[model samples]
Target: MSDATQNDERSQGVSRRGFVAGTGAVLGAAAIGGLGLPAQASAAEAATAASIDNGARVPVLIIGTGYGGSVTALRLAQAGVDVHMVEMGMAWDTPGSDGKIFAHTTKPDGRSFWLRTKTKQPLSNFLGFPIDQDIPKYTGILDAEEFSGITVYQGRGVGGGSLVNGGMAVTPKRENFSSVLPSVDVDEMYNTYYPRANAGLGVTNVDQRWWESANCYQYARVGRKHAERSGFPFVFVPNVYDWEYMKAEEAGTVPKSAVAGEILYGNNYGKKSLQKTYIAQAKATGKVTISTLHKVTSVSPAASGGGYTVAIDQINTSGDTVATKTVTADRVFFAAGSVGTTKLLVRLKATGALPNLSSEVGKGWGENGNVMCGRANHMWDATGKVQSSIPTAGIDNWAAGGAFAEVAPLPTGIETYASFYLSITKNPHRAEFTYNAATGKVDLNWQTAWKQDSINMAKSIFDKINKKEGTIYRTDLFGTYKIWGDHLTYHPLGGVVLNKATDNYGRLNGYQGLYVMDGSLIPGNATVNPFVTITALAERNIDKIITADLGR
Candidate 1:
């Protein structure tokens, strides 16, 4: 190992994973407390659906049940405020005919996509053949929403993006913090909110010793080898999955999740999604209530009352609205992920419902500088067939290359001698969301060519490695001749940015009880996974909102 690698490992205490011998008691207690909460929260949300009454009044209402939504709900509920969250997706509590809550990544079913007859796999092709297939149109976990320029993959469930991600809980470097959130207090964030968010999200690094010899991680090893050979820093990234449970899966001592190719769509076990963390704790408080399959259509100041009137639609699994209802709330929070929140706000303003809203409400949207590609390795570099679905490492070349590339897994159940990657670059292009009065919908003005900036930034790292290893780009995974998967983004950020769209603390500029809490508050990108920053910023904003706005 190089000196940089040795220093990185030593600083992280790589020999021991999250569960060290001295921390056995703490880890055991946390497992028993958290591992079973997702199922319970799912069951509770399902039960709450039947009791969701129309025309009911609430003290506080949140638009989405994503990371920011969940964090906001929990903190507000703890501060003696009653919160009701509206989610446009299913509860995901019940098992399918296969006795699993989520579908297998390699065998996608109706449960994989949201209202799409055809499955839009990120890697759309294999061996020069298109791999998408027809599936039943249903309300599913992952939403591959198509726009004019890009397809943004967002999680559509009570737990939001936590339901369908790689569980990579990455925080941006402190030196780059100013660019991530220039208006926020860096000292308070680093000293207080980031740590709280990480603890709440259950972030932990993989055991490096176990990784060195594990068959499932041979792909990561190969990726690290190539990165180090090119003089790049191979850093271990943290995740929200339970490393102990993954070790059990590797030993065949438990049912598999991460080790059995269970990501993208959903992870059946081991992953500590928001359902097992903030959402679970929020439900336990008894002051927080979530209504699944409930989509908010409009928000306006109530004519007869001193609060906001919200229009909601209860939808079925086939994406049909079964009923529409109106509710009043003293306070409203837009916690929907970036796209959902921006779309709703833009439409409401355009239709004159919330016309007083600031002009910046639907501006400053970005795709988090996302791009993907694959490299065909030499015959001697055979990545293992039993690859783990969860990524645990990345190549940090952001300073020199403006790219932080994740050594993502192929997990195709066969060795194809290919190394796949998803690079989060420092691309400086941002798009805007505008109300398309012609189509009666919101449209993002993101051009496909904007991705070229991302492609160049990513090449700074991959090009050097490919040159050193004499490898060629894999053109079969994305399309017949396409080497860059630049059509989509797994991380969607910004819209109602901090200080511009909202007050410095997320309070809407033109409205008093309306708050913007979520990835939409972030301005474009966080230079990393983005969720940890999203959660931490929510933590900071809600603290101030409760004390100042709610008088708590």
Candidate 2:
């Protein structure tokens, strides 16, 4: 099959059955997530065969299918707008030879890292030995994008970061909301958008009673014990994982996902990713279409037309560009997460494609004050061998220590006597993405030394815990004798910040129909897991944009 046809099929095939079963002719929201095979597969295929033909114009074009993109597409499609979303990754709908769509965390293959020859596991070492191994370069799920100083780990697929994240859907505390997005109306978000985003994303808390005794959560319990002993609050954070399904997995009544250590790359089941929530609903609207493996390379104003001309490159599994296509859109939404959107916008401004874009486009980028470390739990406090990858609780030291650390799992399939944590601190350093004209690429000026602030902030929490527990830090997780994992960030925020690079409602300052509706809008930190904020802010921005801009 032609690449365009394959891209179109992968984009719509998984949800086609659900769509057909709901509305007969088009997809419907209630049935698109996991409906069985379409009653009329051939007809559904024919109906969705309208691939990205060159020169075709769409009502709206969205770049990326992450949380922001998914939310924007769903809402716009509901408002009778035809949206074409272009994603730079695979559909991830087809199972591999192992009869699984996603590879397990411990046994990663070509299905793990995006276009890389070697696996870049966040935990680079184990038991004083390097764990990364060579693999065939493929368009995999996780993209450990390297810059000057940091490796930003982002998810690449039709569902975007939702495919690989731990599903820790945390809304910032009401009082801290002002610092997260100062320009936004506090009451509107707290009372309306946050709840809408949480409900739409299927966020729920784990049964605390069950968590107290679950074997898989022994790691979290150890973490809680240490935090409580250190006088820090141990809080249960809500996640997008289906708690009941996880209970069934523990009971051996269903196929295991979280309990089987199915995170990092992707979760095969139970986790409510965008594909199972927003993207599914968008496809069900019958007004939204997608093209996978099609990366947007340029977005310039059309010489003759009123909308923007988007140039896309269709790539293969080996990351080779086979075809380039150009299409026009009446409006465009930059929902490519923080790193992707920032890089694109920065490059566009420098290369003269969108020269009118303000300098603020590339400023105010941050790593969300992310730092990771592991604790050496005493032999008496053994974290279980069979651990759940879906994290459910965290240590809240944000008030005193400037850190909120999630009790992450070390699912090495063995009792490692380790308590892992990913801490989001209150580091105030902001970086910038600059265009490297010499290299014809974008570079982030985020120095490795800048992470010292984050390390110091994180130390405020772990130091007290280690002292209270009379334990030392684990040195084998990140590297040999390395105490802090400060070289990477899973949460990349800002660049095209709200009310800075764009108007109050995400409309680009100089471009009328161009907008940013992603993590790029948040100025650096969300004080918790950023996806819930990304989804909620997108919900708020798109609602205002549609009402004022779209002639609905």
Candidate 3:
């Protein structure tokens, strides 16, 4: 066998078929205390739900149980208004028959994707060998939704993107913040809402001494070493993971998760997703209820009424509609992430449900300039055998070239001298979503070549580091080993943009009491992990909404 092939065998501990066959447990690894565990909460158990098809009228109806929806639910419930939440995906609290709460990133099954027979993994290959396998179609955690030229990976569950992210609670720099959301009050966000949101989410930092010696973060240390060698400022990025728990994990006193290279799917331990944060508080209010497996198919003006009417489909495990329900609400909030919210609004407006919708309804959409690239490191710059899935640092080159590249974790357990990064650059290309009644779908007019701008911006840092270290880019990651995977985005933002599409406080223009409280409101991008900004913006908007608009 070739040296590379031998290395693959040694690193993976099995061949492709062998790894595929051994799936009795989570990721083929024996339960090491805390890996692929901490069952996700079922929607039914997470919050109370009113029976569908019963014609219940709510004061406020929030669609999707994500950051925006959950935050709205909490704030509105705090204001003593009864709220009803609709989520198209399943609740993530329960574990499967395998006695595990989630599937491992390496060994994905029915729990990997949203309605697909084969898994569409972000990390599709290892050592030039394709690692993706067939999975029984089920509503999985990660939804790698594809368009013509790009694949957007979004989470499908109660907590939304928070369920399937790296738990990086990042806020954009103040200098770049105005461009992210110019209409909003900057002082209110940074001084008030950002702090409130971060505190609510339990955002924390890693211990520096522990970070330097922790086995899980050795890959990061190697990255720091190189970034310092190249004279670029390397900085630590805060996370939502519990650092104390991570320390306990490494000490072997607690179950190993981030240390066991568990991320990208979900971390059953040490990581605090929205379920354990906002949604938990929202549930505590007891005024908010969530209905899972219920997809909002149609929304329109109430027949001879003053409120909005919504048509919801209650689907079974097979995605077949078992029942249809209708809800009438005085106010409606769209918290269905960027794609979900935009698709619904675009379809509704185009189909005459809300004809007076602004021309900006489906405009100003972007992928946040996301690009993934890896470099082959020399033996002296070994990235480490054990890599933490949660990245805590990045190459700070945004000042020089408007790119903030996170030194991401490979998390494959067995490392092969490689350094990877997922860069968020300021690529100023925005697309518009057009509704095609023929296909009954929303189409975004974005070209794959649009990513080249981001790639060039990201290369500003990598090219410098490469020249400094005399290394090269990896060829196996995005199709052809050396070529960057420049066509996919984990962060999808904007469609029903803020200020233009909605009033200053997220009230849909020309349609009062119709609000949008999600990442869809951002003009195009957040220039960071969109969740924190999405959360903060939701706070900023809802606080004003509750004070200025509601309780009137």
The parts of candidate 3 lying over 4 Å away from their true place are: 1-51
lDDT of 2 by residue, 1-552 (tens): 755345334423332232223232111211231222212222322332355888889989999999999999999999989999998987788776667888777667777889887778898876445667666677789999999899999999899999999999999999999998999999999899999999999999999999999999999998988999989899999999999999999999999999999999899989999999999999999999998888999999988869999999977777888778999999999999999999999999999999999879989989889999987765667788789999999999899879999999987666667789999999899999999999999999999998998899889998898777766777766777898999999999999999999988899989899999999999988889899999999999999988889867
Q: Clash number for every model?
A: 0, 1, 12
Better of 2 and 3 by lDDT: 2
lDDT values, one for every candidate = 0.86, 0.86, 0.81
Candidate RMSDs in Å, in order, are: 9.0, 12.5, 4.6
Tell how far residue 51 is off in model 1, in angstroms: 4.1
Q: Who is ahead in lDDT, 1 or 3?
A: 1
Lowest-lDDT window of 10 residues in candidate 2?
Answer: 25-34
Error of 3 at 81 (Å): 1.0
Model 1 segments beyond 4 Å from truth? Answer: 1-51
Scored by Cα lDDT, where does model 3 land?
0.81
lDDT of 3 by residue, 1-552 (tens): 755444533433332222234333333442232233223333433432444545877778899988899889888888888898888887777776566566766767666678777767776765455556666666677889898888999988889988889988898898889998889889889999999999988998889988988888888988898888988899988899999989998899997888877777677788898889889988899888788878898777788567889889887544677688887888889999999999899999899988988999989999998999987776556677677788899988888897988999876655467789999988899988899989988998889999999999999999888777766677676554546878789999999889999987888998988999999998777888788999998998899889888743
